[model samples]
Target: MAERDGGLLLFLTGAGISAESGIPTFRGPEGYWRVGSVNYRPQELATFQAFSRMPDVVWGWYLYRRGVCRHASPNAAHLAIVRAEERLGDRFHLVTQNVDGLHLRAGSSLARTYAIHGMIDFFRCARECTAETYPIPDALPLDWAKDRLPTPEERARLRCPRCGADGRPHVLFFDEYYDEPRFHCESAQRKALEASALVVVGTTGLTNLPMRIGAIAAQRRIPVHVVDLEPNPFVEFAEVTGGEFLRGPAGSLVPELVERLVG
Candidate 1:
C-alpha cells in the first residue's frame, strides 16, 4: 500500500531496538542490581526513592549504563528510522521509550524525536531549582566499574551548577509521572491522535504511555503495525487495530519496512 497521504507516521521504539546495538536490556537478568549485597531489581534501582536513599549508588549504576550507551553504535534499525525521517520530513515523528540516545546518535533530529523516558547522558537538578538538564561532561569516567560507589569527588562533580543540590540522571524513574515539558507524554498522545499510522518496534506494551499511544491509534482507526522478535501483547494489539504484525528482530524488519514505505 502507498504511504498515507498527509498525516504523520509515528515510530515508537523501546529497549529491544537498542539491545541489537549491544546494549543490555535493562529488564533482563543482566539488569539485576548486585552492588555489594544490596541486591535490588531493575525496577527497584530505577526509582527516585532509590536515588534519594543512595545517590552515590544510583549514580554509579547509571554511570555504568552511560558507558555502555557511549560505547555502542547505532544499529541498522536506528539508521533506518533516520532515513525515514529524511524522506518523510514533517510527516515523520519518533517517540522512543529508550534513554540510550541511540536515535539521536543515528541522526534523528531532536526537534522531531521525543525521548519520553529521558536520556542517560543528561543530568538535572534534584531540587528542580532550574529547568535545565545539562549533559554530563565527557571528561568524567563512563567506564567506572559497578562494583564500587562513586568517590566523593566524583559525586561532587555531578552536583548541579545552579544550586548546591545533587544532580540526578534526567530520566523518568519508575516512581515519576510523565509530564509534557519533561517526558512529552501529552505531546506524544497528540501526535498519536494526528497520525495516520503507527509503527511500534521492540516494545512489549508493558509501559503505560506506550499502551496509551497504541490505544489512541486503535480507537482512531489508525493502522498500527508491530515489529518484534517474539509474539507479545503488541501482536494482538496489531490484530485488533487492523494492522500487520511482522515477527522478527527490528534490526532486520524495520529497514525493510522503511524501504517499502518510502519507495
Candidate 2:
C-alpha cells in the first residue's frame, strides 16, 4: 500500500487518533465545533480578551476538556505511532491536529511532534503583560451551563500567575488564528514535510487544516498513508479500514501498523 505513495511519511491526524482513549473527536452536528448549544464560539472562547473578561466561561470549558484528556492515556495505536517513528527516526513526522497532548505523553518528542491548535499545557495573561505563558495547577471544569460569562468583578479574580493578568486556555478556537500559523507552526510543518513520509490517521478529511495537509502532501508529492475504522469524507488517497484500530477499548491498532512496518 505504501508503494502507491512516493516516500515521505507524515501522519496528519485529528480527534480520531485520540478517540481510542475516550477522547471525543470533533464531528458534525454533535461535534465539538458545532454551534447553537451554548457552546461558546471557538475563537471567542480561545481569545485572551474573552478569557480575561469571561474567565469562568472559558476556563470552565477548558477545565472540562482537561478532565477528559487527563485520563486519556495513550493506547497501543498511539504508542505504535511512537514506536514506528523510533524505528524510522528522522524519516517519520507525526503532525497532529489534536490538543490533548497524548502524542507527547506517549513519548513523542517536542522536536518530533507538531500541534497546530496549541496544547492545554500553559496559561498566559490576557494582557500578555509578561513574555511567559505560565504553568498552573490543573483545575476541574466548573459547571457553567447555568452561569453566563462572569461579571467584571468575577473577571478580576482569575489572574495569571506569571503577570497577574487574566488568562485563557491555549487551544485554538474558531475565528482565532491557528497557533501554528501564528507561532511558527507552518515552518515546523514545512520542516516535517521536507523530504519526509506522511501517514494520515483517524482524520475526517472534512477539516480545513488537516485536509490542507493532504493537499500539501499531494502538491509536494510526499508519500501518504491513511488508516481509519470507517470511510472518511476527508481522504481518498490512502488505505481504508472498516474495523476500529484500537482493540476492544483497551488495546490499539497502531501497534499493528508498527508490526506492518517492522516485520
Candidate 3:
C-alpha cells in the first residue's frame, strides 16, 4: 500500500547506526572508562546516584563521548533515514535511542524525530528548579579526557542559570524512568499505535521504550521489520510478529530498505 493511504511508517534507531559513524556502542569495550583511579561501566556511571555523588566524573564521561561524536560524521544509514523523512514527510517518524544528534545533523527535522535517550550536547538543572534545557557551555571543551575532573572554572560554568545548582546532562540515566517531558514516552507509545509498520535498526531491544514500542506494534499485528548484522530480540520481534529480519550491516541494508519502502 502507498504511504498516502494514511499509514504511518515508524523508524526506531539505536547506537548501532552511530557505531557506523565511528562512535562506540554503550555495551562495547569503550563503555568501560576510568573515574579518577577507579574503573566504571556505563551502567554504573550513568545513573542519578553517580551524578549526585560525583557530578564532575559523570560530566567528564559525557564530554568525552561528545568529543567522540564530534569527530565522527553521519554515515550512510543516517543520510538514508533523512532521505526517507524527506520523501515521506509527516507519514514518517523516527524514534532514535542515539544521543549523538547525528540524525538532526544529517537533516532529519527535529519536529519529526524523537530522541528518547536525550541529546548529548544539552544539559538541565539537576535540582529541577526549572524545566529549561540548555546547550553545553561554550567554555567547556567538547572532548574531555578520561578520568579527568572538572576544573574550578569549568565547574562554575556547569552551574544552572536558574538556581546556581549543578547542571545535569540531559541524558536519561540508567536509574531514571522515562517520562513525557524529557523522553516523550507517551507520545512514542501513541505513535506506535498509529503506525502501520515499525522498522527497527541496529538495536538489540535492550531498552524499555523501544521494546515497548515494538511490543505495542506486535500486539497490533502490524508489519515489524528489523535490520542488523546479527540476530537479536528485534529480529525475533519481526519474525514472531509476521515480519522479516533483514540481516546485514545498517549502512548498506538501511538505505536499501528505505528505498524499497518509499520508492
Candidate 4:
C-alpha cells in the first residue's frame, strides 16, 4: 500500500505508551466515574447512552481527562517514535489507540500518525451538523476541576462552531463503531497488512480492530515485535510466530528499538 523503498514499519501504540508520561491507563480506579450515588466504569461512562442521559456529567468527566492529558508531557517512547518518523520518512506509520496527542506533541508528523481513538484536544457537533472537528475553546480552562460542571458561558462556548448545536468530544465513544474518516480504522488495518514489520507497544490487544491487525500479521508470518513490561497476547503472538519479544518498560525499550531500526 506504500511506495517506500525500504518497506513500511508500522507501530501500534496504546495507553501504555502514555502511562510513563503520567497519564492514567484508564484500566483501574482512575477509569471510574461517580454521578450522584451511581458509579460507572469507563466502558459505561464512555458511551453515547451515558452522554445522552447526562451530558453535563459526561462533559465534566471528559474535561477532567483532557486536563490530565494536557498537563502530562510526552515520555521517551513518544519522542523515540518521532525520531523514528524523521529517519524512516515515508517508510514509517504510527497507529495509536491513545487520544492524548502526545505523539504529535513530541514532533511526530500528524500526516503519518493515525489516532484511531480520536483526540482530546478537539470536538465535533453532537448533532453531526458538520463533519469537521474544531479545537476545544481556549477559554475553557485546561485544568478543569473534577465534578465541576461548565458555567453558562463555558457551556455556550462548547456549542458547535458551525451550527450552534451541542458539541461532543472528538473521541470515539464506546457505543460508537469506528469508521474510515473519523478513526482511520480501515487505513490502519490496511497498513498493518502491508507493513514489513509490526511493532506492538504497550497495548494488550483487547480491542477488536487492533487485535485483528496483530492476528492477521502474525498469521501471515510477518515480523512481529512486542515491547511491554509484562506478558500479554501480543507477546504470545510474537513468540508463536518466531518474532521478537522485548520485555521492559516502553520508555527505555522503544528508544533502543527505534535506534536499531533507523541505524
CA lDDT scores, all candidates in order: 0.87, 0.60, 0.86, 0.86
Quick one: RMSD of model 2?
5.7
Writing each residue's lDDT as its tens digit, candidate 3 over 30-100 gives 87778557888888889999998888888888888887787789999899989888888888999999999
Off by over 4 Å in 3: 1-4
133-166: candidate 1 lDDT, tens digit per residue: 8899776787766655778887788889998798
Tell me the lDDT of candidate 4.
0.86
Best by lDDT: 1
Specify the poorest-scoring 10-residue window by lDDT in model 1.
1-10
Task: Judge candidate 4 at residue 16 and give its lDDT.
Answer: 83
Q: Count the backbone clashes (under 3 Å) in each candidate.
A: 0, 16, 0, 0
Candidate 2 residues 156-216, lDDT tens each?
5456776776666656665466444333467545754574445667777654666766666
What is residue 59's positional error in candidate 4, in angstroms? 0.5
TM-score of each: 0.95, 0.72, 0.94, 0.94
Instruction: Point out the higher-scoring one by lDDT: 2 or 3.
Output: 3
lDDT of 1: 0.87
